[model samples]
Target: MKPRTILLSLMSYLAVTATAIAAPEYSVDHGSYNFGTVTQGKKVQHSFTIKNNGDATLQIKQLTASCGCTAATPSASSIAPGKSAEIKVVFDSTNFSGKVQKTVAMTTNAGKNPNYTFTMEGIVAEELQATPRQISLGTMKAGVPREVTVTVRNNGSTMHRLISATANSNSLQITPKIPKQNIKPGESGTVELTIASRSEARILSGYLHIVTDNPQKKEITIPIYGSAAK
Candidate 1:
């Protein structure tokens, strides 16, 4: 072979070798975690293992969580070829109930797959159950006061204490305050909402805010609806 031809072949081989090792590949053990059923105010955590399958190093650019209730952290920001890292995720179940889902996303420098996402899902059970979630007075006579009642049942394994019940708007007044009460497990309590008479008849819209000793749901709001007419 000619010397010039040999030189050209060597250069082509180096070019191909450089291209093979220039890109990175990212992989994970799993993409989702199921927390099953958990009580409110509980904090759940899980760790996901990440691996670099390509020849180059995988650089984690950014990590983000879907909401403030969730937090995501990485053991290491970079993973070399054939190495692994861990991504820790935590989800807070406070102020949440029923079925809930949260997510964590990460950005990387991999060529084919640069973005990855992980999910968490579970059901949150509340200890205190509120009946008649809202108050609907419909239509009332102007200058005539009325009363409304809400029942709170303890459905969990512990007792719940009722702190106070108040109105957010002056149009809907809470007269003759309801004293605090202790609700035992499997028992229920009453929260009476009294509406005061309005001198000027108009549309009424406000919320009845309730304070409780339940850590899971420290504060609850009940929408109030009604109108006064002459």
Candidate 2:
């Protein structure tokens, strides 16, 4: 064959190779998120769906969550023919206040559209306002009921409950009475506590756990430092 003819054939092969190779297709269900309202020092999570729209299987090369406080995970490594997968995103609300929005980036097998981005948004509230974050119970005798008042007020207008209160050990018991377990906005109440140390639980110096909507400041294991009978 002549050299001119060979050169013409080589040019035609290069043109056909470029046109025949197709790019991959990656599809994400949603691109943005809004948590509406979240409490400070709390955790929020959301799941995103991913589907394949191209002619070939979808392989996820890597994923980069928006921030260090955020986490992202997938249900599977690869998507089968005409199938789908899930991506889970979790946001940590700590040292943050008010409105917040974040994003996550994903890389796939596509040539033209190899990456996709998603988002998460929310609002955080301040710690539950109160006179003191801690309380102290003076000295007491065993088998005697000791009561104390925990002055608490909800700073926000939102309806919330103190949820539940507990003791770290069996040496004490807490009963949130008066308003009898419910307190409205700007309302005042007393959590009647009964700290009766067991005959064996002498000389008590333990803690109690208080859970509330205020995650950052929800738990207050105030010191119950005192002495019990022998």
Candidate 3:
């Protein structure tokens, strides 16, 4: 073989090898975790690891959770070439019940694949009522009377009575009829809440709590929301 031809072939092979090594790559050790069964009013945590096998540094541009109940913290703000990092995830199980599924997404600075995803799953007991179970009375147009209701249901088999009712503040009035004691199983009842905004609030809001046999729902405040006409 000619010396010149041999030199050319060697250069070609080097170039191909360099190209293969320069490709950017990233991966998460595990994209999912199973929490199995968790009780209500508790919390759970999991972690995922990522490695950068490419020739460039990797940056996590953003992290978003599907729900506010979940959160995360990663060890690496930016990963060095041929390096790795860890991302920790946390979930609040308060008031959530019966098979919970949540998702979290990570956005990266790597141009090729900018987004990655992960999932968490577990079962929650029905003992916790969770939040937003109550109703809110938002702003009513200045002069209009605001009448909103809070729903109370006996999802459990045990009979319960609304011996008393309450609102977060004195801005509203709530009461349960004395004669209407003992709500049977599977029965749904409403507590009439009357709120006359002493002053025009762009938004009127508060919590309504019902006293009942349900430990989960006992004194649970349901959020109320209404916006007064601007």
Alpha-carbon TM-score of each model against the true structure: 0.82, 0.51, 0.51
Candidate 1: C-alpha RMSD to true structure equals 2.9
C-alpha-based local distance difference test score of model 2: 0.70
Question: Model 1 over residues 120-183: C-alpha lDDT tens digits?
Answer: 9989876787878887888887667787788888877888888988777756665535554898
TM-score of 3: 0.51
lDDT of 2 by residue, 1-230 (tens): 99999999999998778656644577777778788887667788999998877656788888798789899998886886578889888998876667888888898987678888889988876445443445555556666777676665654556556766766655655454434445566664445566665667655666656667554666545566666654
Per-candidate clashes, comma-separated = 0, 1, 16
C-alpha lDDT score of every prediction, in listed order: 0.84, 0.70, 0.70
Best by lDDT: 1
lDDT of 3 at 121: 92
Candidate 1 clash pair list = none
lDDT of 3 by residue, 31-115 (tens): 9988997656568999889888778778887889999999988897799878998888999987687888989899987757879
Better of 1 and 3 by lDDT: 1
